[model samples]
Target: MSCEETQEQVSLLIDAELEEPHQVALFRHLEGCCECRLFFDSMLRFSKAAKRDLEEIRLVADDILPLHGPLPVSVRAAGDGANSLPMHPSGLTGRRSHRRASEDAVGALPDRRSGWGWKRWTGLLAGGWRMPAPVAIGLALVLLVAGALVGTRISTIAGGGGPMGRDGRVVKPTVVVVCSLPEVQVLGSASRL
Candidate 1:
């Protein structure tokens, strides 16, 4: 295999995912090419060092903050108050003594929700959005009504005539004749385009 091909297979080899035939070909190339052999050895060293460092880090992390198992009954029942423990994104809820009350916004709010009505309203919309179901339905209803109103035909007098009485009375026209309209042209729906 060429150098690039050998390098590409190096990861698969490290993971034990390379086929025997390909692994043999790669190993043969590594033995003949001093450059490729050095590259392969360096990669192997890097992998070993990375694993060791990660294990050390994991041990230190466990000692500093062992975020495992179920919460204590008292902390679980404490709710989201200032006195309650704050949870990390990884679900590591700290002890109450580790908490700082001033940093807790919920703890700052008064018992009455009415005091922060505007804030409460906006808070409902803050997270990854999904319009509230009621709001979505109301919007759909408004669009339907608007479409109906816009689609409704505007009424004009029949036979392009004035509102002459069917009883043959020469009465004043309640609706004006469009044919007798002045210089203006009335195109109705055709004008929309």
Candidate 2:
């Protein structure tokens, strides 16, 4: 067997998961190959060190926590309650307390119950409006169609005659010719010398 295959089987053997035949083969390879034997030895040492470290960590964690269970009283409320928010048993503050504080600071604002206007529309946009799947699809289609119409109108107005003209005809390309007889005569005179 190759050293690579032996090393893999060594790991499985350490975990006691390798088959009997594979284990015998791995041992025979380890006996013949010095490098494979060294690799197996190092892996065994690393596995033992890892297990020891994990055990130490588990012991430390067990000592840190109370033997009985978690404390019933809130840790935040254990000290003076002067500046601390009253925490619920589940560790969340009551909504009413938050609402009261906000109301006192900002005072009462005017209620906006009017139909969809700029302010309401902007607020909905800012807050991220969630439409139904069908509504979202329909809106996307409408926007796409409007964008295409706008693009077509802009291209027509710009007079590049893109694709089709306003008359629904394919516009022909226009070419202009320039005469350079003066420069050609200068070149002909130079060539004669």
Taking all chains together, each candidate's TM-score versus the true structure is: 0.36, 0.34
Candidate 2 C-alpha lDDT tens digits along 1-193: 8888888888888899999978877888888899999999999999999988975665554335332234445633342132333345554333344444445346433333434655555445334554444544555565556556556646664785545656676554322222232111111111110
The 0-to-1 C-alpha lDDT of every candidate, in the order given, reads 0.55, 0.56
lDDT of model 1, residue 77: 44
* Candidate 2: stretches off by over 4 Å: 66-193
Q: Give Cα distance to truth, residue 89, candidate 1, Å.
A: 22
Report, for all candidates in order, the number of backbone clashes: 0, 0
Error of 1 at 133 (Å): 63
Question: How many clashing residue pairs are found in candidate 2?
Answer: 0
* Highest TM-score scorer: 1
Q: For model 1, how does the per-residue alpha-carbon lDDT over 1-193 read when each residue is reduced to its tens digit?
A: 6788898898789888999989889988888988888888998999999988975665455335633347686654443342334456676544422123223323443334345454555445333234555554554565555445434422332334333456754333232223321112223322211
Highest lDDT scorer? 2
